[model samples]
Target: SAAKKTRTMTTQSSLKDAFSSYADDLNHLNDKREKVVKASRDITANSKKVIFQVHRISKSNKEEVLEKAHKDLAAVVDQYVARLVKELRGSDFWKLRRAYSPGIQEYVEAATLCRFCKSGTLLNLEEMNASLSSLSDPSHKPLQINILDYILGLADLTGELMRLAIGRISDGELEYAQKICTFVREIHRELTLLVPRMDEPYDMKTKMETMLQSVMKIENACFGVHVRKSEYNPLLGSGDPSYPLMGVAGGIDL
Candidate 1:
């Protein structure tokens, strides 16, 4: 047991040494881009914080948290897009642009969960007194999201890894996620650009619907999203219309 303990400690120390060495290099390389990438991964917690903050904000100002996150992620994503575009200087530049497109849709869709929850229309809630409709009482709010949470966890981690891999490119092995970030950022920037124009009528819902429709088609075409309905509705009551999602296990609206 004592020898086992020593071995465990040695392994831990070795891992620490390896991480320390990599971090030092990451901190020093290419204007500390690796550190920035790591920092981005660390900010995943901020998404949860923002989501909860939205719920808190809902109680106070009747403000939509999902909208707030959409605005926030959109703004930061825009800032990063500019930075990312600056990174793509060679033949591979277009790939970076191509990658961010999926991200743009993801963030937009991710915001919807918070939006629907704040609006008391959380459709995935399993124990709601009534179906998704205009509610007269707070008790009607449902919170069934076992499946949704599981899917988002995977996507978020996968995307975070992609971000770090992108950040580390040139300093390390080439990472395709950087290009992915660029593509996503471009889409976010384009979507947000429409906000300030003030000339368009109320088309955001329509636009998002259109975007989701397009996304579904693309995923179906790519074979990235699959359809597998259970015999019974897991969250909502048995319904004619069911939400089809990506991932083999299925995902939330995010």
Candidate 2:
């Protein structure tokens, strides 16, 4: 009887130890995820600031607006993005993507906006990640932005581009407005084909709807410009004579 009791106690003790260890591990993981969530919030807030800064750019003060935006973006990477990079590990990058994605997307919006304003080119995802690479430790695999985040960010960028196009048109920069129309139209068309291939089609679908609206807004703005230009051409006969109707043609196709 005593030998049987000793074996029973030993089994109970082993189970207790195992459960305690499991509980501790779960607690640790929960804490880690909480840190990631908080970091994500920080990144989201700071990244929005960067986006706002970039939106301040105008044709006249391009250099000054971008300079300020660049500084704000750098600060965001240093302060908030770095925290995200530190907390996230290999699988955690994808696992916690939803938590951090808004921030990352906002960052992408800002970076690409600045690039477009400065050079009339999209900032590729590779370049955005390359810029982020320095924030992570060299020994650890750098935190690279995945394609999904990049794509989502790009979707949001169309909205900003729409705003920029409207502003440019009001500023009498018709050519710039046309360029934005062309760029947003291309993005909308490409995303229409790409959305179904994405992992979760719902969010992309919603964004695609919004993106279509952005495209329309730019198109309408450009169309208005073209119409005004055409109507005034004969009356004034003094403005630039080479205004092309290419932008209106693209809008009609949409």
Candidate 3:
């Protein structure tokens, strides 16, 4: 109905439409969030399984286990992102676009397998001590610790321990040994006391397990028994699945 002399169109109705659009957009955003959350949950389960199984094996086989875990994680993460990207092709997802396409590109990019890790550079005890000796001049001031730095400092700590334990010499490194000892003690204490934070979804972790589980499912379907490979594949580089035919851990030519 044309009002008495129509004051130009009020912007109120346009604002309402805009708000409605915003609500729809927010709902769409939530749906994507839920998907990533679920995927992250799956990936976390995989990470835990890998950690547990790898730790059970001989210390000699740590590299193979770690490499396999890395590969499995990379593949699974790629698969997850692929699925999310596929969904964005749907008509319903068309109007609900901002920037992140299903919200996993960053994760996929970061989950790369380190080639340097392929070498038997076992972030062990010797390197740790050497580093500590070099960095130990900070006697005037104690070193700061955080998760990343702590783990990064592992090789040096391990070296200190080796020199103390194996060389039968704990004199020169008494302070460094004490530092390493304190670090390990604190890490273990936290593990024992704190509960696994099941808060944020553990991304890429579940996706890896899902990939492994798919193999088990296939084996169960065909052989009627789970014939999935218990040992991790090591020839992890692109190309054939040939295990990197170079070195072996101990006597096992893995």
Candidate 4:
């Protein structure tokens, strides 16, 4: 009976030790997740600043505005996104994707916006990931922004472009607004085909609805500009799309 009691106590002791280690492991995981969340918040905040900076682009300051935007975006990558990369390196980022996904999406939005503004072209996902390759060590798998996040960010970009289109139309840059309208329309059409295949189709479905609204906004702005231009010169049949609007009835309202 004495030997049996000793063995029972030893088994109980082992169980306690095992449970204690489990608790420690859980606590460590929670701490790491919290750190990644905090880093994500920083990345999101700085990426937004870059977006706002890009919005400062104008017909005259294209080069200067894009130069500053590029610099600001690079700062976001080096300062805030680097922290996220460090925390997620070697680990399966998919596991913590929910925590960092918002920031990644925002970063994609800012970077793509800057790229599009600099050159009227879409920044492909592979190219975006390639840009980040320099930030990672060769030994560990680099943290790549997954397709879902990239698509979500692209969806958000249309809204900004819509705003830019309205402003460009108001500024008498009807041709620029039309260009933006065409670009956004193409993006929405392509995204419609791709969204169905994305991992989280439900979330992307919501974005696609919002993207449709953005597409309409740009289309409306361009349409309004053409209508106004036509009205101003009844005989010219829409007149010169690129002609400065200041010549059209003291600048038409968008």
TM-score of each: 0.25, 0.89, 0.34, 0.90
Residues 177-209 of candidate 1: C-alpha lDDT, one tens digit per residue: 233344334433445455444233244434534
lDDT of each: 0.38, 0.83, 0.36, 0.84
lDDT of 1 at 154: 25
Give a tens-digit lDDT track for model 3, residues 1-254. Answer: 56733433556667788899999989886786566456544544553443343333233554776677666655544454334334433324323322332232223212211211233223333332332233223332211112222232231222222232221111222232234344434433443332233222243234324433433333233232112211233223344433222223323444
C-alpha RMSD for every candidate: 23.9, 5.4, 18.7, 3.0
| Regions of model 3 farther than 4 Å from truth | 1-9, 60-64, 81-254
Residue 220 CA displacement from its true place in model 2, Å: 0.4
Clashing pairs for predicted structure model 1, backbone only: 96-179, 97-183, 99-180, 100-180, 100-183, 100-184, 101-183, 101-184, 125-144
Predicted candidate 4 versus true structure: per-residue lDDT over 119-204, tens digit per residue: 88899999989888878888988778898899899999998888888877666666777788899999999999997799988988
Better of 3 and 4 by lDDT: 4
Where's the lowest-lDDT run of ten residues in candidate 4? Answer: 242-251
* Model 2 C-alpha lDDT per residue in residues 88-171, reported as the tens digit of each score: 854457767777777788778878887888788889989888888998778788889899888999999999999988888766
Which candidate has the highest lDDT of all? 4
Error of 2 at 198 (Å): 0.9
